[model samples]
Target: MVQLLNSYISLVIERVTMTDEQLVKECVSGSQSAQKKFYDLFAKKMMGVCLRYTNNYEEAQDVLQDGFIKVFNKLPDFESKGSLEGWVRRIMVNTALDAYRKAKKYQKDVDVDSVGFMLDSKDFIVESINADDLLKIIRAIPEGYRVVFNMFAIEGYSHKEIAEQLGVTESTSKSQYSRAKKMLRKILIEKNFVEESERGH
Candidate 1:
């Protein structure tokens, strides 16, 4: 993947206007220029998704490279029933999940009950924090909590979906998400992004 990206990076390819379908058709037909164009189109936005799941930028880049490789290899299977970008984003997310599973031994899971830390009925009003700061705060969370948090909260996956994807119980997913929110709330208060009093108990 690294070598593939390096070759793309070395090329001084000229940009051309092509719709997603057109790009995919050319790419599937083995156009090197078209492949580079496809890579350039979605790499930045997908990198943001990758960053949300990874511990640091380098790991995110690695995920991004691997994701693109999968995207190309699986391009023939794309049905075009959805937007191409959406399809690519799913590949990137799933690629990240694969990385998370491979590193599972380093993470510890807490079999938290459904009753643990019910922040669902409460409200939090975070103030004046930019996207970068928020992303940093999320990246600081422990691996188990962070992955579950991103999948459930940000990606809009249900606890059942998360549990199935991560090979855990639905309750485990819920508990991890609750803990992630609790930790995030604590960071917001400590960093003065939200006042402790503003949070509902």
Candidate 2:
């Protein structure tokens, strides 16, 4: 009986929290209350999302604000066929990409025909690192590598897409992502955050 009552309470709480679709409908209708609630729901997550693509706090804040502006302006065109969160996420990503392009951050020319190199497999051992520590290490990566890494590894963009977006060759995108992974692994190893093979076992 106690377990059943607990489950019932959980369902009640879930029902009280508005779905993303419900929020979108309200936002599109220009409901101030809904807008406030939507901001409260996604602001922090969107900030973190922006931070991953930017070099510093100020740039991140700018991206976040700009992304939100785009979201509000484009909300009416959103088709409800898919996840509203996903639609908003794409906008945030494109906003970040636009910021990077406008900043002219990609300056290196890469030889696409160059041989592809492999990263050390040991880096995958970093499964033990906490989310916060992982984020810190990722943030420490240089801007070029950081952007590619976040897009490829976290945001699920392809090398071709990354290359096109950053105005670099596909080889450059792949190389930067590999370098980012190697650097992150090195940082984790130096911090003694990840156990050596024997210790990990």
Candidate 3:
């Protein structure tokens, strides 16, 4: 009877859907249950964002936890100027970038222009690949390439904006993005996702 009563209460709690504003208010009001619910709400999606920026699941998990901490701490300041999810996503991305910068792996700069990459988006039909496959390919690339690619291609940030964020020149951002595309196409071809002829040579 005790176990059944606990399950019933859990179900009732799960069924109680609060608006973002309501949840934020509760969280700000120092409610542990509300805070847990808020974390549960955005954790998965934010984890995906963190994963795109990190090398592996473990690193991503760290970023996710850090990001959520920031989110909850800053929740009182969130003025509902945008969707809560969008706000959370921005925090996750920034947190991932912070982790990247702290790791100092981005110190090695590759002269991507020397590789003579064709700077065109018409090269690969990325839509042919599923999200999981694409994510795997993204993660397989070098960290610098991965960061530039995620910022420029996936996140819709312009090269100039990406350069500002990553503390590199615009040319470097462009070169890295081009190199990322070339690497992605090469990987796709190697994986048989695209035909040899369609390798965008």
Best candidate (score: lDDT): 3
Off by over 4 Å in 3: 1-17, 105-108, 111-128
The segments of candidate 1 whose C-alpha lies over 4 angstroms from its true place after superposition are 1-17, 106-127
Model 2 lDDT tens row, 1-201: 999999999997875786777788889899998898888778888888888888888998999899999999998888788977778888898999899888866746333223222335455446677766767788886777788988998788999999988878999898788767666655666787753442221
- TM for candidate 3 is 0.82
TM-score rank, highest first?
Answer: 3, 1, 2
Model 3's lDDT to the true fold? 0.82
* Whole-model alpha-carbon lDDT for candidate 2: 0.78
Task: Give per-residue lDDT, candidate 2, residue 125.
Answer: 48
TM-score of each: 0.81, 0.79, 0.82
Task: Give the number of colliding residue pairs in candidate 1.
Answer: 0
User: Compared to the true structure, candidate 1 yields what TM-score?
Assistant: 0.81
lDDT of 1 by residue, 33-70 (tens): 89988888899899999999998899999999999999
Q: Indicate the TM-score of model 2.
A: 0.79
Work out how many backbone clashes candidate 3 has: 0
lDDT of 1 at 160: 96
